[model samples]
Target: MSATPNDPSTPNTPNTPNTPSTPDASYLVDGLRFAFGTLTVVPVRVTRWDREAARGGMLWAPLVGVAVGAAAALCGVVLLALGAGAPLAAVCSVAVPAALTRGLHLDGLADTADGLGSGKPAEDALQIMKRSDIGPFGVVTLVFVLLGQVAALAQAYGDSWARGALAAVVAATAGRLALTSAAPAPVPAAPAPRAPS
Candidate 1:
């Protein structure tokens, strides 16, 4: 059911006197640190891993993408300027992110493919994904997806290297923004139970 105007939980309503508050400055910084540390090879120290910090981190994930994408775009631009072919430039663009992120997203994609391809029950699918080894499905998906990325970027670079770089930035930022958007909102804490009489 849709929330009513009178609902106490409805946030940011014009009439609602108590809307949800934003994270403090310190928490915001912590969140950004967590996002960078978790998502990239950039060495950032994140001391807070609590729920609040997690929400902050999730909110900040897309910002980390800006840095990642810029770095990747730089690699491609530099390669192209150094007399590298479009294909080579594309390869470097893709490789830069994989190296920086330690192939974390690629591994996730593989695991997801394995799980879906198994056509098993949830538990079995989870087990299949948990295994360290990549199955046929994972291998196929990774190969094709990586190839597709390279091909697309190669085409883009052929059109204009600057456009390819800009595309890289946009793609990376949008991908991370998707992660942030998909993150579950933080739930309020439950009150402690009253002592028995």
Candidate 2:
């Protein structure tokens, strides 16, 4: 005897009113699995809890920051210990954290600068940020940011590479967490597009 339309175990048949979605199937489950797999890298946990977890779906930016910073420090150590050139070490040190975090904070910095830098109304400022191009204010801010990082790394000195590593851990985590805590406003789903400033 064959199972009727009421039988959910059947395969390749279009689900109808008779059969309901399974409790186990869900987007949230898939997302959670993906997030755990990407962030914590625990393959076991990924399978344990699932649903297409994109963005790494981190619960806290500070944890992400500390992890990124530690990774950067390790990269720095590798370069320095391997006798890589000073420039190479410096570049790698900076890049490790930047790349590890996938540059979200930097984008935040750039956008915030763009929005606030524009003298126009708040809506217009936000529009400037959505655009692909950067304004003069953006360029200036980027330069200063680069310079400041370079200066900080340089000032960290040979003996302080370890401290630089610690600082990275402390600074990124503390700063990101602080920003997150301070953000009282709710995020809008989408913003109106506007011409570049």
Using lDDT as the measure, the top candidate is 1
RMSD in Å for model 1: 8.1
Give the TM-score of each candidate. 0.82, 0.61
RMSD of each: 8.1, 9.7
lDDT of 1 by residue, 126-152 (tens): 778888889999999999999999998
Task: State the number of backbone clashes in model 1.
Answer: 0
Model 2 Cα lDDT, one tens digit per residue, 127-168: 788887767777788778866775676455354667666665
Clashing pairs in 1: none
